[model samples]
Structure formats: structure tokens, C-alpha cells
Target: MIDRADFLARFGGVFEHSPFIAERALDVGAVALPLTAAGVHAALVAVFRKASEAEQLGVLRAHPDLAGRLAIAGELTEDSRNEQAGAGLDRLSPAEHARFTELNTAYTEKFGFPFIIAVKGLTKDDILAAFEARIGNTATAEFETAKTQVERIALLRLTAALPGE
Candidate 1:
């Protein structure tokens, strides 16, 4: 078991820059002291579900573009950096980096936010393929799709942060 402060401190970065999810979960008693990743995720989802569309969009936008500016500038959150590296985003050849930049620009220009995917098990090719496929989706559909991907990312991060998985 842990205190609220400890819980927030540990899991604050789980949702990129959205620590309010943790705080809200605690306030609603959705998170028990000795948290399981699933419980925490559910609580965060509950909060997300109740949020206004604008708020949800803000959360989605909070996430960095994969291998985008933040990564190049060394400004990504530790979790994001590690996740990108895990998917081989950190070691992209020159052509690969340019392709990612192009796709990222196109996706953001189209949807008004970064293209997101939970890259835990995916390769660079997989991420690129997803970017290609998802860019064709309508804005409404892409908004929903991005939110779903954020949930998947939160779950993966929560699981990794849990004491025993």
C-alpha cells in the first residue's frame, strides 16, 4: 500500500503529462492504496469518459509525436523516450527519420494532433504502417481512434509501473 502522494509521484507520468488523471482517480476513490494497474486504468478511463470533448482532445495532444521534435530535442518524458526506443524509433536511419517527420506533419495537419499508437510491441515499420492507414480516417473517427490508443498506452504504462505486474 502507498499514500496518495506516493501514488501520484510514481504514476504521474503514466499518461504522458496528465497527472490530473491520477489526482481525479484518488479523489473519486477509484484507486485503492495498493493499486493494481487495471484498477488505476479503469479509474483514469472513468475520468476521461466524463471529460468534455475539448478536454479529451487536450489529453491526446499532450502526447508527443513519435520520434518527433521532443525526441530530437531530448525533451520527451522518460516513459515516452523509452517507449519510442523500445520500438526502434530512436535509431532511425536518415531516410526513416525523414519519412516519420513527413508522416507526422501530414497527420497533425490533417487531424490537428499527433498520430498516436501504443508502441510497446510494435516495430518502426508497424508504427509507420499505422500512420499511413490511420491518416485516411475522418476527423471524428480519428479522434475516437486516438483516444482509444491513449487508453492502451496508459494501460501499458500502468502495468509497467505496478509493483508485481
Candidate 2:
């Protein structure tokens, strides 16, 4: 177990980029760290390590569906997630919602994965706009964007849950 103080320290290593993530994530990781960043190098290494090709593709598909609900748990606060879910593409005004649904479905079909954006601080309109813009990308391009976005989300979650990066 990491000492409380030490675990909080490691969380920094996870999300070396982006302040928006910093805002959305709670500091519970700081207080709960020894248990949170519990695996030492293995955990951090898992974030950076290579995986089988299938696993790599799975990673691309791992994000929550754009209009799908966020996963609930005691480990994470429900309020924050409710806020995230409220930010869903389906909740937009009719025209914008239609646009978002069209883009989300098409993006999924073309990429074989849900479209992901951090969506933490973004408005519903902003997220839909991003989705529309991204769908124009080729499969190779969209894949990389999704991969990058997920890494950012993982880093954000890690920063919120672990200590000492």
C-alpha cells in the first residue's frame, strides 16, 4: 500500500497534459493513493506498455459510447458522471441531436468504435461539432484520434486516482 501522501504524488505522472481534465477529476486519488496507484511500476507500465494487436484495437473501442451512459460505481462519484451523461449527444435540440446521431452512427460504422471526446468541460453543441468534424477523417486518421483521446482520458482518470507519477 502506498502511503496516502505518496500515492497522490504519482497521479501527476498519469496526466502530463491538459488542464480541462484536471478540472473535471476529483482529488480523491490523492487521499486514497496507496490503494489507488497501488501497483507501482506494473500499473504505470500497463499504461505505457505494448499490447497484442487485438488488444490494441480493443483499446480503441474501449471508450464509453457517445450517447451511451457512463459506467456507475462507488469508486467514482455519481454526480460528476451524471453531469457527463447529461452532456450526451441525444439530449441536444432536435436538429443538432439529429446531426449528432447521424454523425455518431456513421462514425461508429466507419471506425468500428464509438466516437470519443473528453467531453468533460465541453458543451453538448461543442461535442457534437467535434464529432461532426472528426467523422470526415479517414479510418486511419480517426483511429489515431480515438487512440489519443482515450490515452488522455486514462491519464485524466489515473491522475484523479493515483498518487506520484
Candidate 3:
């Protein structure tokens, strides 16, 4: 069996700042030995999905806004920093930054959570397009969409952490 501490240490940040998902996975016996990326992701996602709506919203809110204050201030978690950097979010022009900030505010005010997308393979333009498009979604639809994006982000993190999954 994998040691609990070791598992938590490796996967704790898979869901952005929500390490409690890892804790809950262990508490509820969702983790098993011989952990693969897919298995670990499934366990973590199952725990996330089973959480109350409020808890889920808290998880969503834990994420930093893309290219917003956290990114500009260098306060993003290591995974988020790397992901955003990879997507060229770190290289936005002043106008692009302003646009992102504006869209982020509008999206958050509309959906009650930061706009989220898995930025691994997307360019800044792609992200901006998605942000603009998703900003118009209804609250319920956007909430579900954000939750799905969070899951996708978790899976990407797990795959990077575990490799060869």
C-alpha cells in the first residue's frame, strides 16, 4: 500500500489549493495500492463529485483567476504557474492583460467562480476566446462547466505528476 503521507504529498495539490480532496479520498478508502494516474484521478474526482455543492464551490473559488492578480503578483501555486506559463499567459500584452482582467471580473460576477480552462495546450488567444464564449452561459450551466474544467485540470495534474498513465 502507498503510504498516506506520500500519496497526499504527491497528489494534494492536484485540485489546485484543495488538498482536502486528497485527505477525504484517503479517509473514505478511495485510494488503493499500485496507484496509476488514472486510478488516482478517478479516486480524487469521485471524492470531489461527492462533495456538497457548497464544498464544490469552495474548491472552484480556490483557483486563481487566469492572468489576474495572482498570476501577475507571482502568487499562483507551482502547478498553476507552470500551466499558465506554458499557455503563454505569462506573456500577455497590456491590452490583453486588461481584457483578461475585465473578462475575469465579468465571468466571476456572473458565475460566482473564476473562469477555468485547462491551459496546458491552449494559447492565450484560445483561452481568451473560451473565456469570452463561456461568459454568456447561464449560471447553472457555467457552474457545471467550471466543475468539469476543474476535473480536467486535476486529471492533467495527475498525468503530469504520475507520467505514463
| Candidate closest to the true structure, highest lDDT | 3
TM-score of each: 0.94, 0.59, 0.97
Q: What is the per-residue lDDT of model 1 for residues 1-165, given as tens digits with 9 covering 90 to 100?
A: 558788889877677788888788788888765577887888888888787898888888999998999999999998899999999999999999999999999999999989999999999999999999999999999999999999999999888877533
What's model 3's lDDT at 9? 90
Each model's number of backbone clashes? Answer: 0, 11, 0
Residue-wise C-alpha lDDT for candidate 3, range 34-134, written one tens digit per residue: 78889898999999999999999999999999999998889999999999999999999999999999999999888888999999899999999999999
- lDDT for predicted candidate 2 compared with the true structure: 0.55
Instruction: At residue 21, give the lDDT of candidate 3.
Output: 98
lDDT of 3: 0.91
lDDT of 2 by residue, 30-132 (tens): 2323444334333443443344545556655544555543432323224235435656643556676566667767888888988877666678878877887
Evaluated with TM-score, which candidate comes out highest? 3
The list of candidate 3 runs beyond 4 A from truth reads none
Ranking by lDDT: 3, 1, 2
| Candidates 1 and 3 compared by lDDT, better number | 3
